[model samples]
Target chain A: MSDQNKSLDPRIARLELPQGESIVKPDEYWGTFEVFLQEKRGKFHQHVGSVHAPEQEMALVFAKEQYARRGKCVNMWVVKTTDIFAFQLADEDMFATTPDKQHREAGMYKVRDRIQEYQNRQK
Target chain B: MYGGGFLPEENPKKQTETVAEDPALLADFQARIDRGEKIEPHDWMPAMYRKQLIRMIEQHAHSEIIGALPEGTWITRAPGFRRKMALIAKVQDEIGHGHLLYTAAETLGKPREQMINDLLSGKSKYSNVFNYPAITWADVTVIGFLIDAAAIVNQLANSKGSYGPYCRALERICAEEAFHLKQGHDAFVYLATGTPQQHEMLQAAVNRWYKPIIHFFGPSDKESVHSEQLMRWKVKMASNDDMRNQFLDMYVPKVREVGIDFPDPNLKKDPETGKWNFSDPDWDEFYEVINGNGPCNAERLAVRKWAEQKGRWVRQALATPYTKSTVPLA
Candidate 1:
């Protein structure tokens, strides 16, 4: 037994570890599961965080432990991290706008003034 | 819970213009801030604003990860299954907060790996409170309740800051911290109202932690410098002294109601100013601790370094190129 382990609280020290060392394999990794939490009923699920698990069922259990232990979450979905696609930062320019688009805003119109003018003419 | 007031080093004379920007664009940016518009990642902002925000967010993220280590050690020895489960969940939430803050900081153009390297190299700073050890289980309650309360006071204000990603991150973090406060208060109440031994343990822990709790808000506003521009940009939401006073007003009565006493004999409220007044907590010691001389600074960093080194293989393996899998749900 290592000296550090001996100094740990007996409760933790007694927890068994798997026997023998395991070799790391290339191109293999613990699956990363992305967690989405639904805050309440009728609410859309939002991405919360991720956890590593060996299988989908294990991912769900781990997600519950990591993200949904609180009563705030009513539902949760766990998907592999690799499954999600995203736009690179370089593509941010595509979201830009050119020229003015004030016509799309309510403040751009003077409808209230025009309505008052029509009302006066009607009177 | 660890995102408390951060006092960057005094650099009042430091130049704010390294990368020159157009004067008209700068005026428009300041006008947008005056109108309370949030600055998104792609927005045109001064170089200094981006640098300060990155520094603040990175520090906060580091604080969360290191903050978890103290209470995390007590999980296995939490005395009961209920406490054990709660402690584990709380620590996990703190780690999650760190990841969220890292993502928010990454939006400012620094990679997460570079931030971690800065933390490992001691080029950045986290909350000084984590440098002290959680010696007893009762210390966990003190930290969870009192320290978390201090952080909420700071974070609630920062949630309204002018940075979109950081403010959004703080909004979610504040919500989770509220739950942690409840758990901490519940555990504290149990001990304070329990047997004589339990009460004694609780009191001792409180006394031991009182100084660090007071230090949690950083230096007094009068002694702080290089914060005026940051506050104007909304990178720093509130003054240090204001957050500390707010924390004391909200919590002092509760602690007294529990029949516990703070170590400071001069601790009281000023009726005229509606502010907290207490003896100085030795700013020299605060400086020393933040300079990496505190009791557990070395230990905390060593553990983090070990985790990073051991997990390198896992991170590398995960980075390997693989075909994206689509699993069907029944």
Candidate 2:
């Protein structure tokens, strides 16, 4: 924990920084915040937000302030960017097999309607 | 008087004090923001406006985190498997809300760690209502139903706020809160209509939570200073009193319909004014709670501090030596 304040270790810093062309990106320091958004409490987490923070401590703070400012957030997860494995947007089509399916959904409203229809038929 | 659109009336108090900003500059800023311009981190804003937004947003973030504790207490001891799962999901949502709010604050160029450190150091504020203890399981339902429902009203108003990110965040939050309100209302309905003992428990919970709900909106407009600047900046879309009245107008009848009595004897609706009148919350108590003197303040802070301390290793691990190569953030 004491090491949380220390600058990047010399060996790790050398390994992390890209050489030459990749270094063309001007913003050398990039941080990742893992975001969990709640529509409200008692619901599954929706990935509605993320932010960049240099450290885990900062990320936690950033996550709460950035993601949970409104009264609706019930929880948040802020993790360093390196930990999350996500597919690139350039490969978006590779993950889009059944991207738009609206017909077969059955939850909350659907269940309510189905139950009401069944009760009406019985009546 | 009813569902007032955008900004309402000019402040009469401005006659006594010089308006803080050059009217033209403020108007220009307001017009740009009204046109759906995104106010970036380094954008020019009035000092008072920035300070007020920070206070409001940070307190809101703190409220989301602390609001979880009361309901979180009931998770393990919930009456049944379904209730337990519901409580767990609710608490998780509270954590998620905290994340959304923190990000909102970060856009203001304030360091997130500084805010958390301030909260832990007793230098920041959260909602005053959270300072009250939740001593009964029925209190959990009251929190979900009445408290969350009231919050939804305020968030709905904020969805139209002038600040771009805050407005967007409020839109998402208000959408989620619709579910939360229903879940809480369902829980309250089950308890309120169940066994006699359950009914009594819910009645007691309502009695305890009612005053806190009134206090939830902070204070009347006269007592608020930053409110005008906040309104001008589109930071706060509704006055504290206006939001409180909306809560009472919506929830009071709902509570009565459920066969429970709210504790306030003074609660009555003025038909002509279209407002519900109720006894004011103790401003002293509200200030005390915001200043970290309320009943649950110590416990709430202790829990957060413990989590931070206990999780120190986890945070350190993420910053460790070997994994740095594979995990280049950029």
Candidate 3:
């Protein structure tokens, strides 16, 4: 009912501050875009954070300010988070490969040992 | 300082006591935490774990948003051009930090709009310190220097915490806070070492803020109804008492070195135990302020409500019909 609550901050005190008027529906927000930042020219643009925006261009604008304000950013990319087809974190086990794939490993076939054996066989 | 995540202990049963999750999944999750791995958004976390993290992160996000206002009020009134520019940057950084924390919280299933609604309707709590008014430039210096220093202590500890997104957000926030602390400390030192009038104003501001500073780290461990599972999960990196002691040990000397004395006569550390002792900062006042009866609580929420209400049209206009907003996968 009051124009403004009595505030020590003069600006607030002078304004007609509104109260109890927020009615944002659950889906009434701009979509979230995941922001990736490249620290330098040669670096990969790693996902730093996300920003909510109306479109791709605005997302990049917001992403630059929010994620790259402090860092030495050469470039940035913004992709809608909904666009990302990510594997669930619980499926981390799926990415695990058997360590016993020794045949596939470079260090498995030891050239040093083979050379030593060949010289000994010659002797 | 932004105090750690807090929920009132009224519902102790639902809050921390019972484990209602599947034992096998819970054990697997606990094992992952024990191995020093972060809990990502889609991980099979215990219900209690998800609930508590959401509450804590949401509280932290709200604190960052509301925390900007007290110092922000001083931007136009800042004494010099340089101070004004620094204050402006610091305020923007605080708002940006709030957005980062909100995104982090969203990964845990709560929507950002809902969080804002809860904050506006007073269903959630933020750091209690922000409810106090910054009446003078000296108050701004105290907040910028000391309060931010305290936040860094809490936030650094939280950055080592188990939650992935929250830790990442805190890392960025803590980095930016360095500039805020330095600028604040410079101004506080100027006031402390300046003329008698400046010194008097600084002292008065310190006296007003001393109790809130003590209340910054939440209740001491003895009084707090915290769960041990939170500690085991790395959700809580340190106890409230340990953090308070650390803050005092690091900062008491800094304040004393500049000839600005804390209002308490009994503030001192015991050489034997390395613990500082001081007069009781009224826990009653702490509780009352948190319950929305503080000097600036009404004003703070009122202003926040205004922002949400005023900004609604732009957000609504920007909403696209085909866009589907989902939880961020990080």
Candidate 4:
């Protein structure tokens, strides 16, 4: 489990209500679904927005209306908000790194200058 | 899609208050605009630019939310499951657009809550077209198709504006609106070509909405104020009359093709100049409606107030301090 999930309140982390439980509203329990859309065949699905739906079919239908109504998408995927794990804001520093990675950039190589020098010599 | 015609400020003095910037800085700013560089959120802007952008974008955000109410009423009453789902989603998209626009406007220094409060108190004005009511199901189609089409004309132009965030927001909104236009046109066609009763309903709706549609673009350029500087700043992308004429050129033929007659006897295009000439929709009534005396003005505000009140608990609940027991993701 992720560190963020590990730190979640035990009451919520351990809580799993039965299907159709009325204590907490379905919207609150069934929760949101994150939508991803692929604009056309073979394209990567892009994260769009979330929708509230109790089931997958309903979620897809809602996704179609919310994300694909303009024919901007040919395919979509909806995952339960709970099923998706994300790094916590507290863990954002994990992405921080030294800015000295010039070796990975094209500007660091000077390939164009070297090629021009070679072409001048060949001429 | 709905923002057209700048609303006059309630206090002219507040609008004219110019904070003195260094002449060089002002010239540099204007020079950057002349060079076609977008002014980012953190960029230095003249006080007037900030105020006018806030006013224009906040009014647009307000228009989105208020505009939702008229067609939102028809969600449950839509003819079928297909129409019901589409209406609900369309209205939801409108509310989402409002959220996006409010965020864009917030970048100009006004809080969304303050902007909405201004809307509720009538300190801020939405599009005047929404001030009129959507009286029938046919009205919904007319609004969705023609009104949205008009808004597209305006929005497409605004998308080319110099404000970075508002332009970006309009780009996405215009894309979504393309589908709304299609659905609207489909529904309108179904009713227009259906039974004679359906056709009559649609014709009446077209007649009822034609004046408001004309009014949607606001007053002519000849009567408008303060547009010259706005155009130079790229804040007002197109003149109201120009957008109205463009809308007519694109949609009037399609509307006529569907067999619905516009109420205006003089709504004909001048082939010589490619301008639309029509009897002026009653400007007096337009002024009165914009000043808060339209048929559905009070009703629209009341409904918005009710939604605000009813949604307060949910907002409050969401605002509650996160507890150790709370699962942030869920």
Candidate 5:
């Protein structure tokens, strides 16, 4: 409001803003939700980013504004960040299939090649 | 978006200067980085890495927020209907960028409110360029064109950085920047090739903005504390000087082709060395502006503080039992 804080832009000058310190309270930004984006009709929704909103509907709106603004996003899904179960990044090696379970892998069945060899031997 | 030149203030007591960590864990962290794996928010990391990233990302977010203020001043006065729409869209994108980045930084444990408090209280810094005013439409274009380009260079390199959340945020920010750059270039070219008065206006803007543009990347790497460990950790993807040079290399010709160039006569490429050499941009002014003494520094902070104060009721009215927020899991 004073000459000391006078701004060049008329809009700011009009606000007559007083100069001082102000603090925002914790959680003033609200809860978080992970946004999932589907680029096309047949594509699966992949997690892109998170948005802070009070509820799922507002979360979807914010997600659209944030993640889908510049890209080809056909649809979006918003779930509370708290809902997703995640494994520890350090435990990444646990997901790998052990070599002993090769029988369960389709590639491990070499029966077709073995049959070819037996047929050739019979010939 | 214009986020670097941040070497965390070094104190002899503790900083990047020295911090002892468990060697085995440090090695594993360093190895992960070396192998180009992103360090996620939940993963184990060095205290220094977390601190540095929090500072850089927070600073960047603050930059995007404040960076919009100067341009937001011009929406009513933009030359035509299309430019008005473009400017409005670009400004919104910038604010959106700030919000996205705050979330990214929050994942590192500092809450978004704390970051806002820091910004309002002047405990942190944003890009120094926003402290300057956009005196004319030409000035806004310069900011949209050159400042955005500079940010892209800084951010593109940062997108390759080892932190997962930061890299993700930068990827999104950079995507929208293309439109901002094109809109800026179109406006700038129109003025450059238009009437003599328009040409003069744009020229004056370029003359005034060149020094700040030079300062935008931060202090020279040679003058500042050497952040070798940060580079090794991928916290710093490129040196400040390197990013500055890259900007000048890409943009100088673009400016010159339009019959206007930066004011510095010493600004030229040494064909022998393939590097641009420009006069010293007066680092003291840069530091002075950063310490809150520039032309518009007071106005900028004052406006930000006022917005927060005025918006208090809305925040409170909206605050349900849900107001107890937690840091987002990335």
Candidate 6:
């Protein structure tokens, strides 16, 4: 119930997925495609989606082909999917959840008024 | 039996070996799951759970990142200005989806940098579909109609997953994806009903995509070692086979109605079982493609690496503390 104290830090060092035998060869396919999009030409291009492509040239080609086709874009960007970072959900309760209630939500001190009233009466 | 990557580890080798031995703790984990409470970022969790979630979330994130490739290519070449604008919006929506997913994954304790680093270093994995080259303008429609359709099926299911953050992200993403599916379908219908060349183009695109679309389900349920564990933990809302069946039921008639024929000669609907059946996907190729050996793998990776290299300056500039005096004039 008291999850308020947990904070998100987007700048932490990344985790590495152990590399195994890659499905695609280094020469055959571009590693991965990373995509970002701009709602309009002047707006910031935010990261959106990724795909595996053969090269930067190809990724850009693929990005333009795969992501910007239907009708709602002014500009688009693509990179390698391998270059981005991500997180896990299984530990959602651990790194973000806390046990003590005193620090989480402000509502934990619901009886502050009552305590102050009792002290005033005694005085 | 295996380990390493993402979060920093002292021994790296011993990281995977780190496991909670207490049965009580395991029970507590199960109890938490039962409470319908979101597992926050800083609570005790099993190592395997952490590993699995990282793998799954990273891949999902990667898929979002790469999935934007094909459509982005079509923006400049869209047959009309309206189509171009619509395509651009659709691409932006995908970017929004990535943000939602990255935020969701962050709630699980890993830093966004670490996740991105893993991807850059080739220590993380994403979906296999992006590795295929998009060869034609028609391929754009195919990707939108068929690829996004497959993704929507999966994302809709993911919307109900046990993880609160993932569920929320899926909720928003699925909404946008519905529009994407329609746009693609609309494109497909237009092309299918257009001139003979357009119809032929649609048909050829369908043939090109059918195998990849079917393969998008990942390995079949029978061969997937992690499917059972993921289901047990509610990480996976539906089995692979169930999702495949759902995709088939929704699309087979739709494909026919659009006047595009499904490529599988063996594809058939079993009235007795009320399920569609077809030749099995080549699991070996599926595994190979996902592992990073698809036709366009190297090309894709190189593009990413180069972009990252080029963007280093931008990233570094952003990382520098902002001072009002040094602010550049817009």
- Tell me, by DockQ, which candidate is best: 5
Candidate 4 reaches a DockQ of 0.04
Note the DockQ of each predicted structure. 0.10, 0.04, 0.61, 0.04, 0.67, 0.03
Candidate 3: clashing residue pairs, number: 0
Query: Which candidate's TM-score is highest?
Result: 5
User: Quick one: ranking by lDDT, best first?
Assistant: 5, 3, 1, 4, 2, 6
TM-score of each: 0.77, 0.69, 0.94, 0.74, 0.94, 0.67
Which lDDT value does model 6 have at B240? 68
Q: What share of the true interface contacts does each candidate keep?
A: 0.00, 0.06, 0.66, 0.01, 0.70, 0.00
Query: On TM-score, who's better, 1 or 4?
Result: 1
Per-model C-alpha lDDT, please? 0.78, 0.66, 0.86, 0.76, 0.87, 0.63
Report the C-alpha lDDT of model 1 over B207-251, residue by residue, as the tens digit. Answer: 999999899988876544457777888888888888898899999
Q: Backbone collision count in every prediction?
A: 0, 35, 0, 0, 0, 106
Query: Which candidate number maximizes lDDT?
Result: 5
Q: Mind giving the per-residue lDDT tens digits that candidate 2 earns over B171-272?
A: 766666777788889999999999999999999988887777777776676445546656766777788778888888888889899799888788999899
Off by over 4 Å in 4: A1-123, B10-17, B222-225, B322-330
Judge candidate 3 at residue B188 and give its lDDT: 94
Superposition error at B328 for model 2 (Å): 17
User: After TM-score superposition, what is the CA distance of residue B233 in candidate 4 from its true location, in Å?
Assistant: 1.0
The sequence of per-residue lDDT tens digits that candidate 3 reaches over residues B84-139 is 99999999999999989989999999998899889988888999999999999999
Tens-digit per-residue lDDT, A67-121, candidate 1 = 6766688888988766777676446567676336778877788788899999999
lDDT of 5 by residue, B1-330 (tens): 574547437453455354688999999999999998999998999888888889999999999999999999899999999999999999999999998899999999999989999999888899999999999999999998999999999999999999999899888889899889998999999999999999999999999999999998887665444367889999898888889889999999999999988999999988998888999999989888888888888888888888898888876776677646767878
Considering only chain B, report the TM-score of each candidate against the true chain B: 0.93, 0.87, 0.96, 0.94, 0.97, 0.86
- C-alpha-based local distance difference test score of model 5: 0.87
- Cα distance off (Å), candidate 1, residue B245: 0.3
Model 4 lDDT tens row, B14-89: 6556789889988978887889978766677888888899988888888899999888878877999999988887
Q: Please list the residue runs of candidate 6 whose C-alpha ends up more than 4 Å from where it truly belongs after superposition.
A: A1-123, B1-18, B223-225, B322-330
